[model samples]
Target: MNKQDALSIVETHLTKKRFEHTVRVAETAVTLANLYQVSAKKAEIAAIFHDYCKYRSLEEMMRIIETSYLPKDLLLYHHELWHGPVASIKVEEEYGITDEEIKSAIYCHTTGKAHMGKLDLIIFVADYIEPGRSFPGLEEVREMATTDLLKTAWMISRNTINFLMEKKNRIYPDTFHAYNDLTRLLDGGNHFEQNAIGNIETSSGSM
Candidate 1:
């Protein structure tokens, strides 16, 4: 489906406020895509449909998880994470959006995964730092996003682990894997450091 069609379908699945947030995420994702030289169209599509199943009832999501052959262990964690995976299925089955990049981005946007691609990183970070969102350390994350997308992703992943621990919530294994992957990427060498600095310069000029 095209951008406007995706937007219309997703808006119907979300509340007004959530729809607004989805729009902001799409806008942010497109900007990040431009910064990183990825496909803005894919990013926009992923962001628009990222939360397609957010408001689904727990019973409904559990049913989807069971029948759709999603990891049963997912049931052990809070249902908030279910929407990302479920939405990936729903979009493909319902809307005929079969793009694997977009599906992967939607699937991992909530908790992330190991060795995420650039489009996945863009959607994940855009969801976190979208203009409509507000939380502690958000501004810092926003600045980090401009400079080092990978590092920023690592920070978000670490923060999520901490938050889950504080809430006594069960942490998803994929989240840990994501954290480890980003940590390795950030620590590998001067390549990442140089890219971070270069992105900061470019972002400052454009944004």
Candidate 2:
């Protein structure tokens, strides 16, 4: 689908504020996709639809989760986690969007999983670092995004984990898995030192 068509369809499902956020995310995702050598069209489409199911009733989301191919364990966690997986299926059934790469990016955009593909990383980081969001350590991640996609994703995953930890929330296991996967790729299992990112704080926004 073209960008205008995609955005129009997505706008109906989101609040006005959320639609604006989606537009910003699509722009950011396109930039990241170009910088990181991913498909920009896919990035834009995935970002536009990333929050498609965000405002769905909990009962409807739960029904989709229980009936669809998504993991049922997600029901035990916060309902916020349910939207991504449900949207993954909805995009296919509603829009005839059968692209696995786009579906995977949409499914895992909220809480990234291990071994993410380039397009997945693009949507994940774009959603976090978009201009509409403001959180700790975001500047550092944005700086790194221009040079290194893996490190940027790692920073986001780390900040998100720390934020959830500070709130004493039960984190989804896939989130930690994303951090581990990116850490391994960032510096071969070594930690990012001050010389790299320079005392970046944790993020608590737009996860």
Candidate 3:
């Protein structure tokens, strides 16, 4: 679907406050995409649909999870995470948005996965540091986002893991995987530098 059509559909699915937040996220995603030299169009689309299923009834989400053959263990965790995976399915089936990059970005925005692409990182970080969100350390993350996307992602992942641990909540394996992958990438100086250069080159080619 076109951007305007997608925005209209998403606004209908969310409340006024949530729709406003969605707009902020899209703007933030566009900025991050520009900074990282990724596709701002794709980033905005992914961010627009990121929370499409957020207000779905628990029963409806549970039904989608089962029918869609998502991990059953997901049910055991907080229901909030269900929206990301469920929205990915809904956007494809309902809006005919079959782009893997957009789908993957929405799918893992809530709980990031291992080896995320540039678009995925942009959406993930955008969602966290979006203007509508206000949380501890948000300013720091916002600053880091402009200078170091991967480092910002790693910081967010670590913060998320620590928050879950403090609450004694069950942690998703993918979150840990994301944390570890970023940790490894950032810890290896030469490898990190090479990958950073390569990402810029790839982004330039795509642009």
Candidate 4:
């Protein structure tokens, strides 16, 4: 779908604030997609519908998870993580967006999965560092995004894991999976490199 059409459809499902965030994420995702030599159109659509199911009632989300191919383990985690997986299925079933790249980007946008593709990394990082967001170290990630998508993704995953640990919240397994894979892709880091993650981690940040 074209940008306007996609935005119009998604807007109906989101609150005013969330719709604005979605638009910014789409814009950011497109920028990263271009920078990383990925498809901007696909990035835009996936980011647009990334939170299509965000406002769904927990009961509805639970039913969708229980009945669909989405894993049952999701029920064991916080409902915040359910929207991405639910929206992945909803977008395809409701909008005929069967492309795996778009679906996967939406599916793992919340807690990124291991071995993500270019489009998946674009959406995950874009969603986190979108201008509308105000997380700690967000500016650094945004700057890194202008050049290196992979390293920026690695930073996001690391910071997310750190933030959750500080809050003493239980992180979803895929979150750790993303961090482990990105750490490997980046060939691991030295202690000082690990300390860089500490710069933005002093304050609490959303995942």
TM-score of each: 0.89, 0.89, 0.90, 0.89
RMSD of 2: 7.9
- Tens digit of per-residue lDDT, candidate 4, span 1-207: 688998999899999999999999999888887776677788888899999999999999999999999999999999999999999988888888888778888999989988787778889999999888886688998899898887898999999999999999999999999999888878854522553421222112111
Number of clashing pairs per prediction, in order = 0, 0, 0, 0
Per-residue lDDT of model 1, residues 1-207, tens digit only: 577888898887899999999999999999998888777788888999999999988998999999986898889987899999998988888877777778889999999998787778999999999998888998999999998888889989999999989999889999999998888877774544444423322111100
For model 4, what is the error of residue 20's alpha carbon versus the real structure, in angstroms, after optimal superposition? 0.4
Worst 10 residues of 3 by lDDT: 198-207
Give stretches of model 2 more than 4 Å off: 189-207
lDDT of 3 at 179: 94
- Residue 96's lDDT within candidate 1 is 79
Minimal lDDT window, size 10, model 4? 198-207
**Ten residues in sequence with the least summed lDDT for candidate 1:** 198-207
**In model 1, what lDDT does residue 174 have?**
97
